[model samples]
Target chain A: MIHRFLFHDINEGLIRHAKRYVLVVIVVVITCSMIDSMSAYFMDYFGEYWSPIEYGINEFYGRYPFVFDINSTDKFTIPFGWVLIYLFLAYMIGDYIYKDMNGYGMYMMIKSKKRWYWWISKCLWCVAVNVFYFGLLWISNIAYSWMKHGDIAFYQESDLRMSYYGFGFDNMGMPKLLLVVIVMPLLVGIVQSILQITLTLIFNSVATMTIIAGILMLSCYYGSIYIPHSYAMLIRYFSNESDPDFVAVDAGTGIAVLGIGIVAMVVMGYMIFRKKNVISNR
Target chain B: MKIELKNISKVIKKNNVLEDINYTFTGGCVYGLIGKNGCGKTMLMRLIAGLIYPTSGSVCINDKILGKDISFPDSIGILIENPEFLNDYTGFENLKLLAGLQKNVDEQEIKDTLTSVGLDYNDKRKFYKYSLGMRQRLGIAAAIMGKPEIILMDEPINAIDEDGVAIIRDLIRGLVDKNRIIIIACHDKEEMDYLADKKILMSSGKIVKEMIV
Candidate 1:
């Protein structure tokens, strides 16, 4: 039963979509991190210029790729790669679940015997993908740091802006930085993925995709860290652009809320899945 | 295993697929359901397999309600709509993947089941390459391989040749003495007459006639 329900489902999940997930993460994360690192080292237009090492760490981990200096006249724009990652992850998961539910409903569900088990297996697969994707992103950040500041042990940020130094990088070591940025983003990604997959089952796939995309966009536009998807964004939650002063929630609270949100989404999704008549409507 | 359906009805988008179906199927007999296209034969078989829940009533096996006591049948093999499997995998590989889920049957058993269905167990041809008849044969093999307590088949020989049809007829006919419940849906009346110990005729989501042969 375990083999059929849990292991096999996870194995198939990893084999089928994991490649696409990993390939996208690696290419985008690496390219974006490298570009941000290069700009930090080669170009210094601001009064608050730090070494490329400091810039690399700050650019990779900063919520907004937009320069944070008060004197900068450039319109603020962060790396769009982060946005694409969240959107694409939700899309892949939602598409897969909805297709399975509609296309071959009889073949898979009947063989599995337990509806909840089949759904849970899917959830497990989503979690695995999210973790691996974020883990690779963390590595890309590390690489950027290494290339910009060879053998650098300490972090330096926004020498012209005193507050920037203390906000995220003041006296912080690599270990602490990793915990705040890498681990938190992964937890948040898993949470959002869960919500997306379950909602796709409940509503139309396009509607669910659009809803998730709208929420993330609203969070970014409003500079509010309250969106569930925002929790997964290390920079947005910590140092938002629209509401930089609004730091009402910390990492601990953010993680807790997101975790609770996952439980709630799963509960609601499971209820709908159990009661819904999963026939071949397609 | 004895299967019973009490006042079962299914309405999808207001299309009454099956309405007020009441049935009691005992083991050790082969039951054939005959109906025109769009009738509820396929829906009824799905209800027995616990693939889709009824809009109104419940299905019970040995007095245990499906939705309450179990989400799906504890032990059953089904080929509902199409003879489908992973297109990339060979016939043996497909069977092996599913059989590995329960470990209920070994490699030798899967090979034997494929052979029993007149499929070459060693055939390396992928599922995508198989003709409609071969795919039907594979579906039949999957539905009956482990010999679960209950078997649900829909149009099991829709695309097979004459000899293949004869072989499947004999294979299905041989299952009556095993004390298992077999539910089959087909359009061929002669085949239904020859194989099914009981026959049911359905039209417009209702059972029109039932005869014990």
Candidate 2:
């Protein structure tokens, strides 16, 4: 029963808070589709006409011993489409986390008694939104592929793999992608929310929270970049291997990381919320 | 229903905003919280609303701490600060969203609240298009829509016109008669003088006066 309330509250919060961004999300979707369409067109033209010219140039330069053959229609469409899809999902999830942290919306959800229900519902809703968006992309891609190559067999024949499409359709796929998209953003949002609520309690100004968020983002970015190559390689080895066994290991590790991050965030956010003084809004 | 604050004190960065305050408000009374700017009137109200926690005290409603309970005051309505609304939403849309927070608050109740507050429910204008006075009326409409047991308002009459104020005054009276707790935080002596059954005055975060008006 409590879970039901939390679920309803979570949905209410998303509708009240995140609904305002529907326009922006739609614009992003349209922009992504257009970019995908243009890139596909370019790749098609390049494969059909420019490949022979490039092969001749490389042959004359003596850097290439053989002229490489390029297919006029490849299945993979520049991977820009996938990247844009990921980015759009990231933006929506990131914005939701950001606003919730900033104390703009979701105040009531955060206040609800069923904490786990609220957290899980939010996670699921974000994933659902992402799935709906990526589904649109898949449909567009299929349509474009049909128009360009005349049949599904052409796509199958191409060397290019529709790996991302497979990723989107698998049972555990959307959840894994959502885990990735929300992990870092939600971590940062949770930390920022905690720091904001704490600082607001102590300093009583909204500007302090903004400044802290900016500093935290910058430091995290630079800190990640400066990690030693050996450490980077170790981190990469855990998730980047292509073997089937390694893929399972990678997914398990990813889920564990996501679970830990989310749990830590909720605990911290709850502690801070409990201690926060709901002084009059300035 | 009753709200109790025991020895509540708040200090932000060594600046004391509220100091060792104790008060209890039972159901069925209209309270006017009067104080100068920075006297911690707003902070006190927030404490009651469970928006913020005091530095070293407890706020309880109906013998339960706010965060511990499954629900907050079962039905408590509040309009803090400027009575924030989504700027892009229509007045009716905003009311609908907030009213849906509780059970059994029908569309007719929402329409009636808007009408009683002197707002045209059918107007196509968004909340951003409303004048200052109109916004106040809309805020009142939202506060009353849920038929909450307790209503908290902060300067609800700040930007309202005389007619709007009169309507609000009567609305508070009506709410009180219905055995609801109505708490208004304001500095306007004239309005407070007319509406408040009890006045609690504060200065520099301490209660300077408490009088039955």
Top model by TM-score, which number? 1
| Local accuracy of candidate 1 as per-residue lDDT tens digits, A1-58 | 5435455555545555655766554655555455555555333544333433343344
Model 1 alpha-carbon miss at residue A226, Å: 5.4
- Those runs of model 1 whose alpha carbons end farther than 4 Å from true positions after fitting are A22-79, A101-112, A139-168, A171-174, A222-226, A236-245
- Please state the error at residue B117 of candidate 1 in Å: 0.8
DockQ metric for all predictions: 0.48, 0.27
lDDT tens digits, residue span A135-239, model 2: 443444344444544543312211111221112112334454334333433333333333343344345344554555444333322222221111111122232
CAPRI quality of model 1:
acceptable
Model 2 residue A266 CA deviation in Å:
4.6
Chain B TM-score against the true chain B, each candidate: 0.97, 0.94
The lowest-lDDT stretch of 10 consecutive residues in candidate 2 chain B is: B66-75
